[model samples]
Target: MSGIEPVEHMARISGGIVNWRKLLLIAAVTLVSILYIPDAEQLWSAWLRQEEFSHGPLMFLVALYLLWRRRVLLDYPDRRGTILGVGAILLAVFVYALSIKAGIQNTRHLGFLLLIFGLFLTFGGVTYARFVFPSLILLPFVVPPPSFLNSNLSYGLQLFSSDLSVSWLRWVGVTVFQDGNIIDLGTLRLQVAEACSGLRYLYPMVGLGVLTAMLFDIPLWKRGLFVGIAAGVAIIMNSVRIFLTGLFVEITDMGISEGFFHLFEGWVFFLFSFVVTLGLCWITLKRSERKSLGRGVMSVPEPTGREPAPMALVPVTVALILCILFLPLATYLRHLEPSIPARASFNSFPLKINGMIAEEDLLPGVEQEILQLSDYFLGHYRTGEGPPITLFAGYYEQQSAGKTPHSPRVCIPSGGWKIEDLQTISLPRGDTTVPINRVLIGKGDQKLLVYYWFQQRGTFIANEYMAKFNLLWGGLTSSRTDGALIRLSLPLRSEQEIPEAEKRLAGFTQEVFRILPAYVPD
Candidate 1:
């Protein structure tokens, strides 16, 4: 009876400890959630708006399920929180605060993942962290890739898909001419736009690959190979889709290019790719493991006994303190208004420059709405019989996640123009030289030379990454995020005309650079 009383008393104490730890966890989660409300809103908006990230919600649900499956690890006797989690927590808070101030949602999303990792480490200890690492990593799959990466990847895939589809068509004896990303077939024309870039399939498939890797207990190399195979299958299957579209259009009407059939075919090929990738991966596993594929992947044994040691209070308390210290600062910085300097509106921009007469033009209403520019100027200037040089300057009082200068690298391709050559070249401005992006774009033998640069504050930046960095720096240091994209373009008649076109553009750019400061406000 004496032994029984002691055992019963220990049981009551253990129950009390468990309840206290659970309360601490709840408090921590609620605090973290409140701290990240803005980021959560942005993520939700992205998932709703972009098709590529539409899988975000599903990935998130899968992550929760994976974590739930491993919940038994939380009761293991050896669990002990690590102090290293405090460092991770601090780093996450710094990143969250900085990204919010910079108005970069991607990094904020990263910070969210880091915070989750810190919390898990603080409460569950190293062993439990490793047990749930796969699930933790899956959270990143829910965030969209950065815009710069998305643009370049989509363009590459578009070009590759178009090239391969054209080759296949020619091999099958279909009369088709490949012009940049366009497929020309006498009576019909098909432009491989960004939507057909195969990313729509690739992103989701990669997420599925991650989930599959989590579900399978295969060799590490085989798991990696399976993911690589899944990506390859997506690209190859997309090419096949394009080839089939061309073939169908050749045999039938142009109706197959769009509408219900195109969408249905895309779904069909994606499923096919999934099945093929899965079968290929299955063949790599041992026979015994193959038979038990999904059954035991998450089969964690029941915990033998709960540990009576109290949850690590030091790390959790430190993490909550850090969050409390940073939340108000992040919120304040995120809502801080930039100091936009007084500047002449683009409406007052000079029309005539360098002995040239200029005609003003306005972008279509839809384009203007899409661009979300605060102010802009578009002009075509001509000197006598020389070819006209077009100038476009789009300015924004402040840049946010969705509203900023659209990179010509992204915009030109969408207009059925393929970027054949791109580089940075120095253009003499006053006593110094400024770097500008030079692009040679073409469509069906017609080529255009474009020079563009981002004008942020008083600096001219040609590289997108540097421009983004400067934007963040400016927002943090000077409370100024106003910027503009200045572009100059000229048409070319033939390959031999490029040098002459360059000389003309250089002269026109010199004139425009002289007057740009007034309108763009440095």
Candidate 2:
């Protein structure tokens, strides 16, 4: 910690030769990861298919390269953080086991991160771990978020882009009406689809920001500022481009902004935002240097301490064994799955639940693939001389492999409906109370009362994260990860129409909740 320390003392130990124990530990870790190759391969497939997540694999490689570049700059800490390290290892094993049983890939990916972090503490201790903190932090971004977060974040970005684009268009003498994620420009209608949400550029920009921060000696707050600005810049630039897209359509009145123009515009904005982030980083570095000079504390250099020590045999062995032990558990859970029996088809679902018989026709744009469900029923339910309610049930045979329900909260905004109010509501379903998520979505003067809930393993869940967690738990305990999303959407015309709409949905859900297990296979 002193300036008197020699810079030469911190030189790479023996010119980058790793000791036997550490070398073997790395090999063992690699072997363990190989055992989980299926999961990694699936992720690679996702990276290839989903543009928003395309940068994920590169994040892992970049983190590895960072750690490898500074391998000799790290050293074992004074204190091992024995208790914390052991606790982390145990937590990792428990989570990895549960994830394996439950088919929750995110939790499994989380376990992989914790497992390595725990090893660092057990082997090199906390001080040694700090040397590679930036690399460690980037690991989470490698795993694409759960479906719920993905949908929500994308929806939010769409709304932001639409609002800004709409405002900008209106300011520039173009007649425009903003409808949720869509921009109506009199001559052209642009639906701010997921591509325009700017997530594709935002994620990679943040990754670059993190890498930039790691490459510099900037303060943590400044590093965080760079990351935040990267996200902000991506959104702002996307908004600008969306406005331009609308303007181009308004002026040219041609569909020239679809294929090549789209890609060209995206590249222009992405490069602009990335350059802005880099410029901000350069500014921060210049300021830090000036501040250091003004404080007169830039006189000497000090080594962080000893280079990395030889890996301890006992801790490394324990970590490796724990990792290897969980491999078979993952394999077993992969093979062990819930039973799906032949059940009454949703096609045969009664038109009459609580005296609301199914209507004869389907709503236009009622697409099932959007929900990504194995089986789904979309029908309008109505009683004689009363307002009709839309009943939808999306069933997933297995709620793993990223085949999970997409929350309506994420999809509504893109469909040109803004959620005016959101709250959890409960209804009495015989002996036990059933909880439901309620939302008031509006577009212009039209309003809708929407009630939805996750029916997982015969249990009703309102919270998104808790539903996913319980799904994983169900797979582990009962080999059942099957779930269904039940939604009741009704139009609200008059101010007094809400009470009736609520009553209809409540009465309907009370009856539907009892019979959902038959079709969803809990």
Candidate 3:
């Protein structure tokens, strides 16, 4: 009788403490997430490392907390969503299969989220997904913003930030000249770089706004208004940050706004923006006179009637079988479909082309990473009297993931150079005209003329978006991801006009064009 009493007590404790079916569901989800562990770790690393995605790590904890709070809704026992669960799981597996070869981390994140959705459906059918849907929708903080959107958004934002900052400078009675993204404050030149474009802040603000609304459990209309206002707030704050830095530099020594100090300023302003966001949330909540949805680390969600057993067996079994089969299938699809296309090798590039002499130079460590190279040649060319023009060619036999050429639009401004102007120009190459992106970057009185273009598998792309789309198209069709970035820059002497610079660059291109094809294979 004592043994039977203990057995009954143990059974009772198990039932009241934690459901056995919930344990099974957790175990199944864990097993599935293990397959996507590497991808999750990648996002975590990006969130922790990159300044742009600094707000990313917060989402993981937020998602867990959200699930924990709404734990009551997770219990529903209907096999109705099993087919949909299997479909969602299969969608995840398929996306992984497709995106793995290309190293698209965004797609991997999407796949992992889909896997979670599948688990939710398997456990609680459509009921849980419907009830706790905000958690799924409020998760853009972790995923990196898509590059396709960056092209237009970054350009527009950079221009707006620069123009707005210049206006603020004028309002402060500072003599400032505006040219595209460059702001000449007579004392110090500020280049509103792409990083300063406020996309980073915009992404996080929207993400935080959504989470804030969820936490505050505010009205639907008010929540949307908050998010929309948050975007404008990000832009205004970023612009204000730019103006403040310039004003401080003009008033004090520019040294205080250079290097580490500049980075610190960026951090402080972003923190300020976050605080302001919280303040807005607080004020809105106060006006409504509503208490927070819940408090404490282990608060239980609002009750949602009786708990039911989860239907997990069939979906979990099918998902595992499909995942096992996908591994070998992915290996075959990514490799056997495309052969390595032939291209010109950089081995035989000449040091002396016509009368010009080329002196080779080594790339810096960070620069080497940007130019992910199968082969590369960096040279400074001079005739005898005039200034030397640098030529850098980076060739990639394959560009998988983000191992493509880094654009100067972002890198130049980071290096403390302000872009005076940038445009696309056509350089006459033999019977044809090759279009190239031309830019003028400066700091104080110093200026440089730069021309660059992407020599893709067989096409020359001046536009960054064009290059990206072509790469994507090629990767999808033939799996040929070979490309190269050819860049040339000339430092202007104390006395050199636009015409002289253009004439000199055009003349050099004519001489060097003959030797380029042999190195940058077709």
Cα-based TM-score, every candidate: 0.89, 0.86, 0.70
For candidate 3, the TM-score is 0.70
Tell me the tens digit of each residue's lDDT in model 3 across 1-522: 887996885565357423654676567667656666777787788788766677776766787777667665554445667678879878877777656655456776777677677766755677656544556666656587555455457767787788888898899898888766878877777777666788878778778777766655556787776787677778888888788788877788787777533663466666778788777767666544356544422244554554454346767567557655765665576456444666566656777765778898888875576455778888998887877888888887777555677777766664557889999999888788888899998977888998888987667899887887787677666667778888888888654576798888877877767777767766
Instruction: Sort every candidate by lDDT, greatest first.
Output: 1, 2, 3
What lDDT tens digits, residue by residue, belong to model 1 across residues 1-522?
987997986675557765666567668768888878867898899889877778889888877777787776665523455577777888888888777776677888888778877776776677556656777677787687766567678878998899999999999999998766889987888888778889888887888877777666677787788788888988988888888888888888877555534764466767888998888778777887677666433556665555445567777678778767776787788678778889898887887898888899999997787578899999999888877899999998888665677788877875668799999999999999999999999988788999999999879999988988898898667777899999999988887999989988898898888888887776
Off by over 4 Å in 1: 1-13, 77-81, 256-260, 263-266, 295-297, 302-310, 362-371, 409-423, 439-447, 492-503
Candidate 3: where are CA atoms >4 Å away? 1-24, 77-82, 130-133, 146-159, 178-183, 189-203, 219-221, 255-268, 280-317, 324-347, 351-392, 406-453, 459-466, 473-480, 486-518
> What C-alpha root-mean-square deviation, in Å, does candidate 1 show against the real structure?
3.2
lDDT of model 3, residue 324 = 59
lDDT of 2 by residue, 52-110 (tens): 67778788787777676555434444346744665787898788778777777777777
Report the Cα lDDT for candidate 2. 0.73
**Number of clashes in model 3?**
1
Which model is ahead, 1 or 3, in terms of TM-score? 1
- What residue pairs are clashing in model 1? 457-522
